[model samples]
Target chain A: MELRRFTQPSATKPTHTTVSNSEIAKWNILDRPLTRSREELYLSTFSFLFAEAVQYLQTRVQQVSELEEKLNQLGYRVGQRALELLCFREKLNRREIRLVSILGFIRVQLWKFLFKKSADYLKKVTDREDEYYIEEEEPLVNRYISVPKDFGQLNCAAFMAGIIRGALDSAGFTASVSAHYIHREEKSRLAFTVTIFMIRLDESVMNRERKLAG
Target chain B: MSSSRASTWNKLGDAAYAKSEKVSADLVALTYGSFVREIIKDFEEPDQVNKELEKLGYNIGIRLIEDFLAKSGISNCSSFEESAEIISRVAFKMFLGIRATVSNWNSEHNSCSIIFDENPLAEYVELPPEYTHSLFYSNLLCGVIRGALEMVQIIVECEFVKDQLRGDDTNEINIRFKEMLQEQVPWNDEE
Candidate 1:
């Protein structure tokens, strides 16, 4: 029993029809700034939201891998949108045509956009022609998440990998991306865990890269 | 006196917000959008999805209230009106970086509407025609409010009355006060 701002759905106009004619319909999303002028929400807000999402996914899937996959798929959707938004915002009129360039973009621009810092390291696997790695000291997604002992080798950073894959795949660089936690017990004094994203490009994509190089 | 109190809450909200660590808004918005879509895919019905979202928000709210109190240092609201003000000006700004306006108080002052033109959760979100009418895109918020208040002995019913994604000019959530829970003997003491 509150006063409505817009007109009520009348006999002449149905509820659905009014949506197309409304002010919201005319608004364009691309015109909006990618970043807000005001300060962003508390980091814990995102952490809590992410935690809820992981817990919800945990109920549906039987295995840890499946849960990670679900998280990745969700992150993939975000990554696709992030790529478009970042590209537009940065005024990068051109898309990366080569695999290496796209990888650099992910390591630098994409990471900066999401985490406000570039990834720690990017290296090609000397043994494999189509494999590469992007390393982070402690990924933002995994910062507060402490995986239970029973769910061994299940890294929440799979979501971050999915984001990377989504960006790469959208840029015409097909790759299978997964996240792994690299144990550094052998090192003398490494305090924090390191997450490495293993990106394996498809043979076809590698072929194209070689032809482009020629 | 009321205006001064409002500004004081705003300052508290701002100070609390500044003290907390922050992340990009788009990251939260996009992740939320993806999560909602996943729920819709799994639930396959708008009503069910709304229910699921609300349930999830409730779980978050109960836990989040402790963090809110500890960080904001906010304590006992003298009245429901003051609580509403804190929720709008302080809580929303502290967590979501947005300020909602409280209005349309009923005669008994037990019910009111919280309105905000901008929602960070709905950033770049365009609801499909099928969902525009049936779905409350941000139904999670209603649950969060209800659950958070419940932790403080305030039982209230919260529901989204209007959603901007549903073609409304702004998002409005109407909250009605229910009976305050009376103190009861602790379960441990009963034994």
Candidate 2:
């Protein structure tokens, strides 16, 4: 194929033209109105990128905890942005006021938007009132990842935990979120693998919830 | 015998290519574009942003080759031309769901162009006026090719020669093979 190279006229040249402030403002993504039912991105791309991110973090961090912390930090930033975006798109006029409500929101709304489906289970810790669990049989982030025997304790779901923490923190609920891998043997095919994200709300947050409820 | 072996490898590559999963192209483009935009915002310099994107792609490429090899069950390429064909036919299709054509072979046959009719990364993207000259929007692709080739012991220089986002006729990535990296053999204890 003959490559056709055309010279653009001076007025149409892309290089020298200055974009005014008005144009920049008009094109600003923040200024755009949030639309419901946005198109979904490719899951494979996300998986590949997440895999690379984990690989990159693995190389940088010496300890398993360090890698988890790094992943969590990365997810925290994403969670913050996702919270804002989800709220805007859903047109929610009020912030989540209760512990259960916010956790429900994360498990349902946030999960739906990010993964196109809700998490498998949301449960309260029997012994600890302040601790809650959001579980998934297969996490989207961990779809392509296979943890080695040495790094058996490492749950890549730490990124998701960070996202939960970031979202909760931004919503005025201070909490520590950690991801744990639970292995179960059952007769059914869906038996073995499960990732549970534990959310531990701070004392102040629990107190505030009690005050609001009472 | 070598031809038969090559055919067997080709069959494996085809099977791998066929078995690879598909995903939404829009998602890939938006996520990648947004990530690049975020990097650009952080660096606040186009050159630095390009370097960073390339570095990221290089990291991805190194790991991606492992996935590719495992999936395709292909161990080696007989020549640089064969590698180029495999990349265009099998690797790009399996990963990106886009087919690239290898063309414009140089006199020495060491250089060629991979032309993309459509680019998943540049979908719905327009370069801002200021970034037209400074940003090589898909520099990551070049880095990926370079990194993957290097892993196979083929040292190649790759660059985005043209982009549709830049009002070019088509998207073309030019690759020039420099040299093959020789494998180092370990010393035997008995020797």
Candidate 3:
């Protein structure tokens, strides 16, 4: 397949016959196959790449929150693309309409795809109808990262939270997602931090859920 | 003899990669795409973005060489030629799950080109027309090779001579030998 290189002025529209065939491309990107899903790579490759991303973002921002926001935005891009590719690959014909199902889809399907395991916990806030949480004892992004004491309240899992928000927002479920770190200190056992992804659905989504249930 | 050695390295690469922990390639691709996009957004020029990406990869490479050494379990290479072969056949395979071809060697065997048709980092990427002329999308790989070689006492200048992202036939990283450092003991070594 060949795409003609256009050299004409922008003001006038040129036909294929008038345009010069200066360059030829061997393969069209659109013609590439999307069905093959067996692509796997070393975890260390990702870990190295991700660590560099964090360090690069660190130099670009001042505050921890700002750094996280940038990381989230980057992850958001990935999540948006991942959602479309995953849906197409899985051949999921039905769009997720309800709020809970979309959240479930993210917790089970997206989580499994990215992390190789379903999220450790998915729970609804007892007092709030629009709030939910997906907790991971150790997020894959945070595996090799140990937050220094000097840097406070910088959860690298903000990238994961952004991923959740991106997937949710693209699926037409508007929500605000944030990552919170919970330090677990067990007696006679080693201490570890858990990452909780807090997802808060929008009022419109709540109304739609209520209408669907009614 | 060299063919047998290449086959052994291929087998070693396969074994090491199979033994290591793995992740979905899509995640890596998306993350890399996002990282490059972020760099492009922050930097005004494509050349600047390319430099930043290379610096990022250099940092990663210096540290990753340690992991690569531990995983591959090979202590030494007899010559720079041997190192290039191991890099294309073993290191690329063990890390990225793809084996690149090393060719176009100089008569002195001090330089070579590593070529690969399939790039995992570029699986779902199509370079924007605006950035294709000046940007080397995979310049990070060049930095990685340079940094890793520096750690092994073989200082080499590496750069992307060809990139499929720029409508090239294949991705090729050209490496030129510069210097070799003398071995030294640690600063705190006891007499």
Candidate 4:
């Protein structure tokens, strides 16, 4: 696994690749795992801590729409982390191309990586082009929240949505996650529908990747 | 990229449990407390004991995502079935040192019987009746499952059948899935 094996110029290391430009990676010859520069699992642990921080911020946010935008930002950061891991975790042979294909990867591979199960099922709106959803009841991230009247528009789980949005956006898919009003339908039902806008690549980007894969 | 990556679709029941350490609900709660303080500053801590516990579980949901990823060999747990089983065996076992076996599953949702084979966290624990059947820290577990599954668009419901946080009783959880009710549809969609 050459770390440099990425086929896309876009996949090249972003400026945020690591906390410090100076710290270099060390390979563990014995285990053969890519040993991170630091001894701590701080990156992963802190990533979670940051998620909590995002939720904390949403508590006081009065407007749901404003809160959602903020959450999308928060999730964007987390999503970047997810994207890095997802791309690296893949064998690096060929990249996910078609909308359904990338989604399939997300459902099973990415979903498994994050949750333990892929979304319970997959449904697409035939009327909507390039709009797909991993419809779920009872979003795990939002389970404990009882949103108050003051924060009429905000759902703290929007923080998670932000992470998802960020992850998808970085991977070049223009996506946004929204938490729908889940009450009345079923109090126990918590659904987060992710709407991914198809990234209709400029013909050049598509042609380039196809050439690279070939 | 082993030859196995060829088949992206895998039945979760068939996947082998990842060989990793399990996590405990107690540990998850303790960690989530910080999450609450950090995330929801204005939100006063719930007075009701069960709600407080559920709050902690919510924090755990923020975390278990990363934990679930690392311990399960990162990529081996790829398919939905594989992911579900890994969450059941390795993720739960690594954290809780117990396994929740699937009791019933349908086209979408399923239930699992979580027998507390041994509970160090519950070594001398006791819960009042009000909290006995409560989901406790496991609410985040259900939430995480829901979120993770939703990433793939499978709307499902998960609830505890029993509580290990409580004493002397067998425990399990049920997750149900049903048809998506169109908001404007006047008729009952589930029936």
Task: State which candidate has the highest DockQ.
Answer: 3
lDDT of 3 by residue, B1-191 (tens): 27898999998888888999999899998999999999998996999988987888889889989999999977776577888999988899988898998999999878899988778888778888888888988788888888887888888888898887787877889999988888785867684
For B87-179, candidate 2 gives per-residue lDDT tens digits of 876677666655677889999999999987656676546789889778888888888888888888898888888876666667788999999
In model 1, how large is the Cα lDDT of residue B35? 94
Q: Which stretches of candidate 4 lie over 4 Å from their true place?
A: A1-55, A59-62, A90-92, A182-214, B1-191
Which numbered prediction scores highest in TM-score against the true structure? 3
What digit string (tens of lDDT, one per residue) describes model 1 on residues B56-114? 99999998898899988688755677888899998999999988999999999999999
Full candidate order by TM-score, most accurate first = 3, 1, 2, 4
lDDT of 1 by residue, A80-144 (tens): 88898788768899879988889999999998888878999999999999999999988998878
Ranking 1 against 3 by lDDT, winner: 1
Model 1 misplaced regions, further than 4 Å: A1-39, A185-188, B184-191
Docking verdict class for candidate 4: incorrect
- The stretch of ten residues in a row with the least summed lDDT in candidate 2 chain B is B22-31
Tell me each candidate's RMSD, in Å, in order.
9.3, 10.7, 9.2, 19.8
True contacts kept of 3: 0.69
Chain B TM-score of predicted candidate 1 relative to the true chain B:
0.94
For model 3 the local lDDT of residue B190 reads 83
What is the i-RMS of every prediction? Answer: 3.0, 7.4, 4.2, 16.3
Query: What are the runs in model 3 whose C-alpha is more than 4 Å off?
Result: A1-25, A184-192, B186-188
Which residue pairs does candidate 1 place in steric collision?
none
Q: Give DockQ for candidates 1 onward, in order.
A: 0.36, 0.14, 0.36, 0.02
Compose the digit string of candidate 4's lDDT tens values, residues A98-208: 556766766676555554456654557577554555544544455445567766645565554555556556666665555444433436765444323222324454555
The full ranking of all candidates by lDDT, starting with the best, is 1, 3, 2, 4
Predicted structure with the largest lDDT when compared to the true one: 1
